[model samples]
Target: MRRKSVVDTLREIRLLSELDDGEIAVVEKNCRWKTYGASEQIIDQHSDSNDIFFVVSGRVRVVNYSLLGREITFDDLEPGGHFGELAAIDGLPRSASVMALEEARIASLPSDQFQRMILSHPKIALKLMKHLAYLVRTSTLRIMDLSTLGANNRVHADLLSLARKVTKDDMTAVIQPIPVHSDVASRVSTTRETVARVMSDLARKGIVERQKDALVVKDLERLEDMVEDVRGE
Candidate 1:
């Protein structure tokens, strides 16, 4: 890709979205671009790497493996998203492994350069702080779900969190790109068979409808109530 195009892509990232062309040019100059094939490892958990990664194209998943070798997915990031900021900010080892879900393009900036960018740009630093805060909250919520909720409830919560809000005539919402059962299982720390069973039960009860590309919550209120019921139990 052309240098100008690379700069433009960097500008589109939320962390750098507000940067002026001159600032973006500076970032573009410091970044190193790399591509990975499908299912390739981008970063290993606990590895010492001070560079932060920004996804330019395609998808990647943040994951960790259990002692027994089970894979737990933390998040799926697409273009305009980023990872490794935690390590970059604190100079620690990676908290989780990153893998390309498909062919992907990434831009990496060394920790020192990233720190300089943040120090020179207060707004960017504030954005990074806020993003880190959000990640912390998400992690806390996941821990709570795992500790207090059953596998079935965890599945419900996971799907609800992934769903997009929409209003059709009234205010109805649906989750597009309904995740595969195996993916849901990984996120919820359950077996795929359990996810499939819970999904089937929800479908039979008319709480949710599974379509080709999406999952429609026929009764949003009921679904929410179900989640609450699980939480209270």
Candidate 2:
């Protein structure tokens, strides 16, 4: 693959799209670029560094580990997504660690430069504010689920969430390259065994099917009802 130029990579980020060609060039010139191998740690939770990073290639996961050594996954960023802006804006330590899910290229702008850019571009600053608001809303919902839902219900909710994201037509949804059971467990803050058991029951009920490389939700409505029943929604 041809390595993308820093300017081209910056242009790929939606957050920076408001900048014109010349402005993107300026931003690119100030960026520090690096690459990480699969599963490599990109940032440590509570680290003092506050540089904002853009995903130029590949994917990464935003995560943190509990004192008991269990992983909690917050979100995954594919090409064009960015992270670390909260620390940049607040001048605080990182709230979560990030790890590369695959070999990835990342370009970072120091906090000072990031601050200057956003302050100078009102549109960029407004977009960032909106983005942070979305993050807060999502965190609130996840916290509510953790506090109120049982492990089984959380797992069902997680599956339903994924199914909705990729649902096709009215009856079926396919999570291609089926998610790893352990990974799903981490997202829902449950044990791998629980996830596996829930999946097995769903499969037996013909609500879901396992293909050679994907998990097919055969009855999306049934899965939604399962989650709604627990939530009383």
Q: Per model, how many backbone clashes are there?
A: 0, 0
Q: Can you give the TM-score per candidate against the true fold?
A: 0.90, 0.95
lDDT of 1 at 28: 79
- Give lDDT tens digits, candidate 2, residues 1-233: 66454334588898999999999989888998898999998898967899999998889999989999999999999998999998988898899999999999899999999999999999999999999999999899889899999998999899988988898786899998897999999999999999999999999999999999999999998998999887877
TM-score (C-alpha) between model 2 and the true structure: 0.95
120: Cα error in model 1, Å: 1.4
Q: What tens-digit string does per-residue lDDT give for candidate 1 at 1-233?
A: 56643343586688988789888888878888888999999998867887999988889999999999888999999788989998899997888999999988899999999999899889989999899999999889889889988899999887766653453533346777777999999999999999999999989998888888878878777777788787763
- Candidate 1 colliding pairs: none
For model 2, the run of ten residues with the poorest summed lDDT = 1-10
> Considering every candidate listed, which one attains the maximal lDDT?
2
